[model samples]
Target: MCDKNCSFDLSKRHLLKLSAGAVAFAAVGGLPSVSYAASLTKEERDAMTPDQVIKSLLDGNQRFIKGEGVEHDYLAQQRTSQQGQYPSAVILSCIDSRAPAEIVLDAGIGELFNSRVAGNVSNSDILGSMEFATAVAGAKVIMVMGHTKCGAVQGAIANVEMGNLTSLLDKIKSAVGKTKFDGERTPENYAFVDAVAKTNVQLTLDEIRKNSETIRDLETKGTIKLVGVMYDISNGKVELL
Candidate 1:
């Protein structure tokens, strides 16, 4: 058996060389040997295509919804990632306590870069962060995810005018108008609220593409993928939109 330092070096080299085929196989449930708990290395992240990254996330969600998520070794992951992280995707999600992006997607540490905000809205800072995540850090996918029963979506629908929140909710108001709903368009109405939230995700995607030419060009060139998704808290399912 190798000594401590030798083992550590071996682990680092092994992690760094993790194959793309292993990740792709894991995405489709074709491999059980692939460890989701391992920190993603640059080689592993670089090997995945944008579509594969999205598919892997979806597969993770499937595991989550089924309550079959892989048991992670947090300490091992921490040790593995202490050197560096090479995440494949950057996700923008809500600040809601129940909708944490990593848990819902069954992703371990170092697998994703999460940027959360109220209503999953994008501003200059969030956009800048995403640009950095993709352009600088080599992430291949950007996902804007919104959830059902979001209070921000409710506030926008009700026109709640609190101090700073009023301005933040105002950003989502346009989605309220854009959402075609026949039922009661009130925060109390869960269906309408969810509809607005979904529209908000799409709007945020559009805004990011329009406001950030860097991201738009990367997407146009197929270097990265931009997607929108909705998380259903009631059912623990994430659906791509």
Candidate 2:
């Protein structure tokens, strides 16, 4: 054990072992801990401005497009949000299951107040909901999201009528007339349909501003922003208008 060569080899081995342990510790430390929790708390929501809320949605959409959406613990979020919810935005979207606003935007529970209807059209009831979500609940942004290849747009293009759906589609008819498209102007023309859909979203925004004094006042005072977006079902992309 006292031989010079043997002593040197032993010291080298011990140094190597120590280095390996250090490397392992560093690797473990680099990993995100299981106990690490990230949720949109009331304070966090309250700290964000209307523009910041819109930027968050846009950034989330980019993550969604990249297939890198945030991993959320739904049960934990539910338990934590039980005390109260401080959502930042209210989204008016179509009833189509393919274009869920929360999923496309990569938003968590208690992050947005969602209002769904056949064509994402604003009526008296929807306007009232928007006012409550913004003026009462402190939502900072109002998003009217439409989708390409929407069945409601197609129905409006073809004038399809069935019970309550007839009245609902009637609201979208004005958009069809207002959309300036040189195409065939039929349900068969998808470009025309999508154009009309976009027009529908704009019309809804106009209706919201015209119908709800509370929402308009909030927007006028810089407390909230009204925006329109189109979600493409083909590629899962959201384009702001």
lDDT (CA) for every model shown? 0.84, 0.78
Off by over 4 Å in 1: 1-17, 20-32
Worst 10 residues of 1 by lDDT: 4-13
Per-residue C-alpha lDDT of model 2 across residues 1-241, encoded as one tens digit per residue: 1221221111111121233334234333432222213345555565556766776687678778999776766676677678887788999999999999998988777778999998999899888888888888888899999999999999998999899999999999999999998869889999999999999999999999998889889999988999999999999999989
Which parts of model 2 have CA positions greater than 4 angstroms off? Answer: 1-39
Using lDDT as the measure, the top candidate is 1
**Which residue pairs clash within candidate 2?**
none
Residue pairs in clash, model 1: none
Q: Give the CA lDDT, 0 to 100, for residue 37 in model 1.
A: 59
- Model 2's TM-score against the true structure: 0.84
RMSD each, Å: 7.6, 14.7
Task: Write candidate 1's Cα lDDT for 119-169 as tens digits.
Answer: 999999999999999999999999999999999999999999988999899
